[model samples]
Target: MNKDKVICPCRKLTKGDILKAVEQGASSYKEVKKATKAGSACGKCKKQIKKVTKKALKK
Candidate 1:
């Protein structure tokens, strides 16, 4: 994953941030949202967030 990639522009969250949340046991979109405040804004990044989480889980 791109370390500099900002997944949630609304909250200025990055891919690393999302992964951190995932590493912390956030296995779903809702759980990631609660952990990182991502996909909580305009909702544009929700899909990407889910994708990121899924990728992480696959590993």
Candidate 2:
């Protein structure tokens, strides 16, 4: 995925943001959400956030 791709439009968070959060110890969707507030708004990005979180953890 494009690192610049916006994963959470509600929070204007990009994929890079999530990856950085993962690098900073956010190992789960909930943790990522808490760290970056990515999916905390409309919640529509929950699925994408979870997907990114899982992918990041595998690395």
Candidate 3:
């Protein structure tokens, strides 16, 4: 995935941000949301956020 790609437009968060959050110990969507504020607004990105989070944690 493109690290620079904005996965969450509401927070302007990129895939790298989510990966970084996971690397920093965010093991779930909830934690990622709290850590990076990625899917906390509007909620449209929640599904994508969960997908990213799950994929990151799998690695």
Steric collisions counted per model: 0, 0, 0
Worst 10 residues of 2 by lDDT: 1-10
Give a tens-digit lDDT track for model 1, residues 1-59: 58679999999999999899889999898999999999998999999999999998889
Between candidates 2 and 3, name the one with more favorable lDDT: 2
lDDT per residue for candidate 3 within 1-59, as digits (tens), equals: 79999999989999999999999999999999999988888999999989988998888
What are the per-residue Cα lDDT tens digits for candidate 2 across 1-59?
79999999988999999999999999999899999999898999999899989998998
Please provide TM-scores, in order, for all candidate models, with all chains considered together.
0.94, 0.96, 0.95
User: Candidate 1 local accuracy as lDDT?
Assistant: 0.91
- At residue 2, candidate 1 shows an lDDT of 88
**What's the C-alpha lDDT at position 15 in model 1?**
94
Clash total of candidate 1:
0
Model 1, C-alpha of 14: deviation from truth (Å): 0.3
Please identify which of the two predictions, 2 or 3, would achieve the higher TM-score against the true structure.
Answer: 2
Q: What is the lDDT of residue 14 in candidate 2?
A: 99
CA lDDT, candidate 1, residue 35? 92
The candidate 1 region of ten consecutive residues with least summed lDDT is 1-10
Q: Which pairs clash (backbone N, Cα, C closer than 3 Å) in model 2?
A: none
